[model samples]
Target: MAKEYEFTQIIKDHEGVIFKITTIYTNNHEDQKDLYQEIVYQLWKSFDNFRGDSKISTWMYRVGLNTAITRLKKEKRKGNQIGIDQVIMKQTDQYDTEFEERLKILYAHIHGLNELEKGLMLLLLEGKKYEEIASITGLSPSNVGTRISRIKQKLKTQIVKK
Candidate 1:
């Protein structure tokens, strides 16, 4: 019961992280739902081992990214190229046409990023600090900064080409 409660609390607090990671890795609604379930299961399985060494959200991000990467690689081995054409981010009621166009372009460039780059961008987009992103991604803080700079430039170039 205690573990169940803990898992429930984690889910309530960090479910958005799971969904966002799933969206970044998956191309369709069905795959997104499946990846979300897999992430939740992994979190539950490892919940007992969580030692409070990091924030729960941080731990969740690490686990979520690892699971998504593993799943993606496995699918790749099976010759699957999941194209992310489905728009997961809904336009708000007050959004202008300009915002919508920018959003589409953003998603396009995001889809062009590799798996590791996608993870980094997702973490950055979630407003994680450099240290936190480095910890989750097993990179040095300086490396995180450098990589983010490069990623931004790449994204700029991609959007410019469109």
Candidate 2:
């Protein structure tokens, strides 16, 4: 019972992280919800083995990302699905039209990146420090930095060409 409570609280505290990951990895609402549930399920399955060696958020990212990547691979093996034409933007009135358009463009470019680059860019966009990203991704901090630099330049070039 106590274990369930603890796990529930952890999920509540970090639900946004899960949502962001799901949104980044999935193209539509149904897929996003499926991925979100899968991530939570995987997290719960491994809850007993969590040793507190890392921040819970880091652990969650590691598990969530690995699960998402694995699912994507499985999906590819099952053959291609039709791509959705509409981008999934959060429905918020706070942003002006121009900012929203730019955000859409940004996400489109992000979706074009390779899987590893997509994960790295997602972590960077979440404002995680290099060391945290490195820990979550199993990459050296310097490699994270180098990859991010390349990703930024790639995004810049792509956006410019658009």
Candidate 3:
């Protein structure tokens, strides 16, 4: 269908945003890919709900993040580990450098965070301000700021020890 083609094109145009969310939420290659597919599926399913109330990317992020979070929960309930550590290791093996090592550690720390925190960090990494993150996450602006500060401090401490 022409509509489907246009919709897929729109999603492809914003694929990186979805990939970022998927990467943050899932560590294992399998889970990351599964979650990526799930996000795309959800976007397609919810396309009709788009009412131009917010930016298209904003809506996509909300839906994709929510779907990824929910899928993580479901997988956990099924006793799956998501294998993010393995994925990181494989990635690190491709480049044996201090930066990749540090990045792997940071990724591990991020993987340990809750779903909401992961979403917030992804948005922050994308250069969103606290207010924008709060809008998408339903947290108070101050709370988002506080959480980012704390996360940064935690990462700083970890990086110092390495």
Candidate 4:
């Protein structure tokens, strides 16, 4: 059907966004896959309701983030699950050892952040403007700017302490 084809194409085009979000929210490979599937399912479920009021990517980000955050909360209520401590680096051939180490450290710090901060940092790192980030996050542009400034300072202090 045309609807199915359109949905599949949209998912293919934005799969990286889903992957990044799942990676950021989950520690282990299995959990990441589960989250990824869940996000895709949620997106598909709401596909009919999309009105084109925003960029498709923005809508995807909002839906993906909300689903991830909600899942984390549900997971917490269900009790602690063991997470893999090792960082799994992708595309090692594209980066030097130094860059890989830096990335590991950065991800560790990112994982330490609370959920909201983690979501904000992911969007910021994606090169989204403050207004777009706000639209995705349901925050005002000024608040997004303020939170990003604070998160940067927090990350800098954390790195300096290491």
TM per candidate comes to 0.82, 0.84, 0.78, 0.85
As a TM-score, model 1 comes out at 0.82
Clashing pairs in 1: none
The lDDT of each candidate is 0.82, 0.84, 0.78, 0.85
Q: Give a tens-digit lDDT track for model 2, residues 68-152.
A: 8998433433333333213233555558888888877777988989989999999999999999999989899999999999998
- lDDT minimum window of 10 residues, candidate 1: 76-85
Give RMSD to native, each candidate. 5.2, 5.2, 4.8, 5.0
At residue 31, candidate 2 shows an lDDT of 78
Off by over 4 Å in 2: 72-99
lDDT of 1 by residue, 14-99 (tens): 76788789878877666776677778889988988898999988999999999998874334233343443232344565489999
Work out how many backbone clashes candidate 1 has: 0
For all candidates, the clash counts are 0, 0, 3, 0
The candidate 2 region of ten consecutive residues with least summed lDDT is 79-88
Candidate 4's TM-score: 0.85
What is the Cα-based lDDT of residue 127 in candidate 1?
Answer: 97
For model 1, state the Cα shift of residue 12 in Å. Answer: 1.2
lDDT of 1 at 67: 94
Q: Report the Cα lDDT for residue 65, model 2.
A: 93
True-vs-predicted CA distance for residue 45, candidate 2, Å? 0.4
